[model samples]
Every structure is written in C-alpha cells, then in structure tokens.
Target: MTTVQPTVVSAEAVDVATRGGAGTARRRPRGSRPFRSPQAQELWGWTFVAVPMLLFLTFVIIPVVMAVVLSFTDYAVIGDPEWVGVENYRRILDDPIFWLALRNTVIYTVMFVPLGVLVALGTALLLNRSSRVVNLFRTLFYIPVVASTVATATIWYWLLNPQSGLFNIVLGWFGIDGPAWLYDSKWAMTAIVLMSVWSGFGTNMLIYLGGLQGIPRELYEAVRIDGANAWQSLRHITLPGLSRTTFLISTLLIIGAFQVFDQAYLLTKGGPGNSTLTVVYYIYNQGFGGLKMGYASALSFVLFLIIAVFSILNFRLTSRRQS
Candidate 1:
C-alpha cells in the first residue's frame, strides 16, 4: 500500500469546522442571564395577580359566604347571632308584605320588559338610517342614560306632578282628566314603570342599534328580492336578528325591575300604601331601617333565586326563537 499522506488542516478550515460545535457552545459566556422555566412564569403570573385576588376574596367571596351563613340566623346587629333554622323563610311565606312586594315587582317587570324592548327597538330602527340628523337624534336619546339616576328621578317627580306636570297638561289638551299618579295606589306602580322606561330606554336603544347594525345587508336584500313587505322583513329578519339582544335587554330589565328602589323611594316612598314597595325596597327596610340583617339576607337570596329563575327562563325562550 502506498504511504498515506497526512492531511494538513489550515487555520480557516479549523475555525469553520469548529464554529457552533458543542465545545464552542460550552465556551460561550452566559452574561448573567437567568434560566426561565414554566414554573417560574407561572409564579410570576400569580405574583402579579396576588393583590387583586386578595381583594376579591376579601370583599366578594367573604361577603357572599357571610350572607349565606347569616341568612340561617337572627343577627339583628344588636347582639350575638342566634340560629333560627328556616324560621325566617317561613316568615317570608306568611309575610303578606313580601308577597305584595313580589307581586308588585312581577307586575312592574311584566309591564316594563315588553315596553322597554319595543320602544328601544323602535327608536333604534328609526335611528339606524344613515343621516346626520339621525345621528344627532341618537345622541339626544342617549343623553338621559348618562344623567344621574337620582337627578332623573327628581325630574320625573316634577314631571309626574298631577296638578301642574307637563304630562297632565298634555292630557288636558285632549280633554281628558289625568289621575293622580304618585298619590293614587292604583297609579303609583304605573307611574314608576313609565319613569323607569323613560330614564333607562336610552341604554337599550344603543344596544338595539348595535344589534341592528350587525344584521347583514344581504338578508334584507334577499328578503326584498322575495317581495317581503316591511312587516315581513321585520318579523323574519330584524326581530330574529335582534333576538339575542332582546334577551340580554329583557334579562337586565327583569333584574332591574325586581330591584327597583331609587325611583320608588324618591317618588312615592313606596307609598300610595306600599304599592311601589319592591323586593329590594323591602330588603333595604329590613337590613337598615329595621335592623333585621339576617331576614334581609334571606330575602336577598330569595330575590336572587327569583331573578335567576326568570333569567334562565328568558334565555331558554329566546334561544328557541333564535334557533
């Protein structure tokens, strides 16, 4: 065999061959860089959210737990809480005022939700047309939404005045006698419903406007090509399009209707003989006015359950329509 020549490796060849090799990687400087791991990232996340979590635990979780515990006892804020079993609940069953309040709230919700949805939808439809004037009117409608609830209630108090309010004056022009709204038990709840609708419809109008805008123009065009009338298009396209929005608005209105207090408190003080006393007003009276915190907590849970039931029912009903 011929003698094998020993290969001469040049400096450039050695440098190119050794570049990014394991030995060079080992020799590279780390420069004070810390190694990161999933556990470290997770720890950092928890650290960042620690304060907010603590506050949530302290304020929301703790209070809800305490309310549940307190509902089974009589803690009138004057002495040690004594266990009362379901006696408070039984009292609620027998309490005429509770039933009356529930009825009034139910009636208010029944009257308010449909009217609110219709008025909001109508106004939104009217405002949805492309024009500067429509935009201006949209802003005007939403102005009441930003106004303070207390201030709006005060304004309604003046507006609902039987003798001198603009409402009766308008009725007077029609040659009809307007009844005493706040002073009459029969009209007190109705008056609250009207005021509630007026002050709050602006928010629902915006929601409806958003829903209306989301409807694809193709659907309307298709319906139009099919020779569908305005009512048919509304029934098949517009209403169906706004079904979910209606559900959301209805749920909110129901919850709010059951919890109505500020307007009733300011307008009639739950009077005309307790016609406007809602469940929330009842809870307020017990919790603060009468110092019956435990009973109030029980009432609160009951009201919560009622709202929950209604909200669930509304969701189911609206889901069917949407489907």
Candidate 2:
C-alpha cells in the first residue's frame, strides 16, 4: 500500500485563509442601503407640501376668518371698532332694501339657472353632433365670456336704449313699441338678466359639452338598438349622467347671480329706483360710497351665509334625488 501520510495542517495557514476570506467579505459593498422607511418617505412628502399649504392658509383662510370677525363689529375706517353682536343682522332683517335685493337675487337666480342650463344643454347637444365648424361655433359662443364685461355691458346698453336701440328699431319694424330696457324698473333687471345669460351660458355649455363627451357612446347605441327614441334616451341616459354637472353649473350660476354688480352698476347703476340693486352692488355702495366698512362687512357676511345655505340645500336636494 502506498504510504498514507495525513496532509500536515498548519495553524498559521488556516488562520491566514480565514482572515483573508473575512477581509474580502467586509470590503464588498452591501447591495444598497435598505430602502428608506415608509414613515420617512411620508415625512419628506409633507415637507414638500407645507409651503403651498402655508400660502393658501395665509391668503384665503386668514382673510375669511378676519371677515367673519369683522362681520360682528361696527367698524369704520377712521375709528375704533365696536362690537355690536348681531345688530347688523337684525338691521338687515328689517331693511326693506335688503329684502328687495334678496328678492331680485332670487328672481334672477330662478330665471337664469334653468334658462342657462337649458340653453347650455341645447348648445352642447347641437355641437355634439356637429363635426364641421364645431370649433368655430364654440369660439363664437365663448367670445362673450372672454370679452370685457364692461364693454359688453356698454354695447348692450346701447342696443337696449329706449329710443335708438337696435332692439327698438327691430320692434319698430314689427309695429310694436319697445319698452325702456335700462330706464324702466320693470325691464331693467330683465335686460340685465338676458345679458348675463348670454354672457355666461357659454361657460356652462363647455362644461356640459365635456360631461356629454365623458358619457360612454355604447349607452346611446344600446338605447337606439333597443328601440329608444332620442327624447327617451336623453331623458333616461343623458339627464341621469349629466346630473352632477347640472348641479355644479346651477350652483355656480346661482352664486354668480347673487353677486351681480358689474352689469347693473355700469348699465343701470341700480337706477329706476334701485330695482336692479343686487346684494353685491348694495355692499359696494355701502363700503365704498357710503364708507360704512362694518356695515358692508356685515352685508357681505350675510351674503356668504346665504350662499352657504343655498349650496347646502342644493347638495341635499341633489343627493336625495340621486338616492
């Protein structure tokens, strides 16, 4: 048998090999630092958002809070403010002018909201089917929105003049006398409402158009295949689908109507015995003309509350209807 000699094992050699392996393993970079914790990531995200949040709070939230506080005080620009509690609100409650303004605002909203929605929906429907000149028609409709309100109001003022207005001229051709539009109290608000509707309908129309496009085409096709007529399809599918947009548009229109000032200010100046005095125009007169800052703030707060309540009611009604 060949001489079987055990290989000599050296302590120094084993130690050297073990130390070398350990050194190599320690020198190799770990694959990447373990991913940052979710908590850390969330902290960084909030840190980035803090700046915009601060700006919004500073500009919007603080102003609203300040207004709310001011609403309860008797503040004049040149004097110290006196806390009056709910006196301003009581005064508003008893003021016939305030009631008139409120009534006018309501009338305007009731008349304009439905009319605006109807016109916008009609325009959107017509445009939805038009492939050619659709953009052109949209631009045409949107022109009034982009145009200067003052300029539009001025032009309409001229067009509704009792004597030389184009409308009256047309009325003359029809052997009918055109009533004074801006001069007559009865027609002043009506004329302004008409102008406002014309100016504002395009915005709501665009919104409705977007809503219409978002609706799935397959629904219409299915309804048609099921022998549904256009009116039925519109009633069941279009109305239901567009409900949210309708609510939004109507709410916005109502709010806007309550704040009607520019047209009234420029065209009628709340003339014909203040028949066209909107709440905002009243506040403006109080604040700027009469220099009743506190009173104006109070009026503004009242308007704010009205808007809030109306919005809440609208939301509740819409929710109930949907349910």
Candidate 3:
C-alpha cells in the first residue's frame, strides 16, 4: 500500500503566515488599545466615581458652605444679607433660650441613649434563642420602627393625656395622680424622652440580636468548659463580641437624641415656657417661625459641630476599647 507523507513547512513560510516563526510577534487590529497599567486603572476607577462626588458636593458640601456663609450674615427671607460676622454667634452664646435648649437637649440625650441601649440589649438577650415565634416577635417589635414618628407621637400624646387617658387610668389603680404629660413643663420632656426610647429600642434590639447570633457557639462552649457561668460568658464573650454593634447603635442613638424634634414638636410644641425646647426645635422656631434665617443657620451649624464632635469622640473611645 502506498502512503502519502505530510509535507514539512519551511520556517520562512510559517513566518510569512504568523508574522514570525518564533510565534511571539503578532499585530493587533489598528483601532484597538492594550490593557491599562495599574495607575491608569486607578485613574479610570476614580473617573467612574466622579458623578457621585459631584452629587455629594452639590447636595451636601455646597449646602453646608452656603449655610456657613449665611450664618455670618443677617439675611431674612425678604431682604439681602448684611454681613454681621460673629454677631449672630455672639447672640446665640448670650441667649438664655439657647442655654435652656442646650440643657434640655443634654438631659434628653442622657435619659434616652442609655435607656434605649439597655432596653435593646435586654430584649435582644431575651429573644436570642431560635424559634419560629421569635421571627414573628421581631416583626412585631419592628412595626414601630417602620411606623411614622408623627403618628406615634400623636398616639402617645393622647395616651399620656392626664384626664381620661389610659396611662393615668393605669396610674389611678395605684392611687397616684398622673401629671399632665404633654402639658406640664416638668413631665413634658420626660414623657417625650420615654416615648422616644420605646419607639427606637426595637431597631437597636434587632441589631444586637444579629450581633449575638454572629458569635460562634464554640466560644460559649469553651467558656462553659472553663467553668464560666452564663453571666461570665456574656460579660467576657458576648459583650466583647458585640462591641462593634454596640458602638454603632450607641452612636446612632446619641445623634438621634441630639436631633430630637418631631416628638417634641408634635406632642408639646416646646411649650409651657420653652421648657422642653430642644436645639432643633429652637432652630425651627428661629428660621421658620421667627424668619431669622441667618441666625437659624448659625444655630444649625453649632448643632452640627456638637454632633460631629460627639460622634468622633464616641468612635475614638469605642475603637480604643475594642483594641
């Protein structure tokens, strides 16, 4: 039988077809570009972020800058601004109402933040065990979180009414006279603070529950093996594990407490001689009610500074504690 042997191609012929016989050299299409370098890739990455950066500048940075500028002026809504320098700030510092508002804000924050954290932690501990009903209970607790603050405030206002109110009726059983909650200067802010704690605790509770669940069971087992009781396990293992979540929740609650307005507004209107007047409430009255826009801007920026300082301090403390 006759067999055909395959022809061996010459190197020169292969080079003509493949650009080079070494099989390394190849020409790309004319219009195509090569891969980017690391620096180029990073430039492109930041290019993609340009739109978001611009949006943030427009929405947040510009508005803040404008407010700062306005704060240095005496601008009302109807007229042009006259530059007043530190006059508005001086007025704020000298204002007794401002002092009262600050005091009330501090009191409200002190009352609400710890109470909210403790309540959330306690509730989360109680609900940490796995069960089908736990999810249902979680949803029930979360209802207030999703509900409107105005609606909740309105409901609480009625419930806290001194005469013919459910809260007083409950207090009546103990033969205690329930003071006018929203009407009395003594009880108005306290009532609002309590309601705020109740309304907000659910959200923090869910967060703590998540944190608790994330801890490995083996750690608890090891603790038990070491003869650690439940309290010891919680203190050494659970709490330390939950540090990040606690820090985050506490920071948020503190900020929220400082910015308290809705409950005070809807329930008390900072009434009974401005006793329950919070910083934000005062800002609202100054800007909108009194039409001192420039002065209000100053007040707002002061509040912003206060919140920023506290938030930074909390973060630093939390980081130190964690480390």
- Indicate which candidate wins on TM-score: 1
lDDT (Cα, tens digit) per residue for candidate 3, span 1-323:
12332233345445456664334324444543445478887988999999999999999999989999999999999989999999999999999999999999999998988899898999999899989899898888777877688989878978997998899999999999999888888888889988897788888999999999899999999999999999999899998899999899989988999999998888888887787899999999999999999999999989988999988988898888887
C-alpha lDDT score of every prediction, in listed order: 0.89, 0.85, 0.88
The reply for model 2, stretches above 4 Å from the true place, is: 1-54
Per-model TM-score on C-alpha atoms:
0.88, 0.83, 0.83
Q: What lDDT is obtained when candidate 1 is compared to the true structure?
A: 0.89
With a 3 Å backbone cut-off (N, CA, C), the pairs that clash in candidate 2 are none
Poorest stretch of ten by lDDT in candidate 2: 1-10
TM-score for predicted model 2 compared with the true structure = 0.83
Model 1 bad stretches (over 4 Å): 1-36
lDDT, candidate 2, 1-323, per-residue tens: 23433333345445556778666456546752336678888999999999999999999999788788877888878888889998888888898898888888787777777788899999998898747789999999888888788989988989998999998999999999999988899998889888988888888899999999988999999999999999999998988888899889878877887788888899888888988888998899888898777788889989988988988888887777666
TM-score, predicted candidate 3 vs. hidden true structure: 0.83
Tell me, what's the RMSD of every candidate? 11.2, 13.2, 9.5
Task: Single out the weakest 10-residue window by summed lDDT for candidate 3.
Answer: 1-10
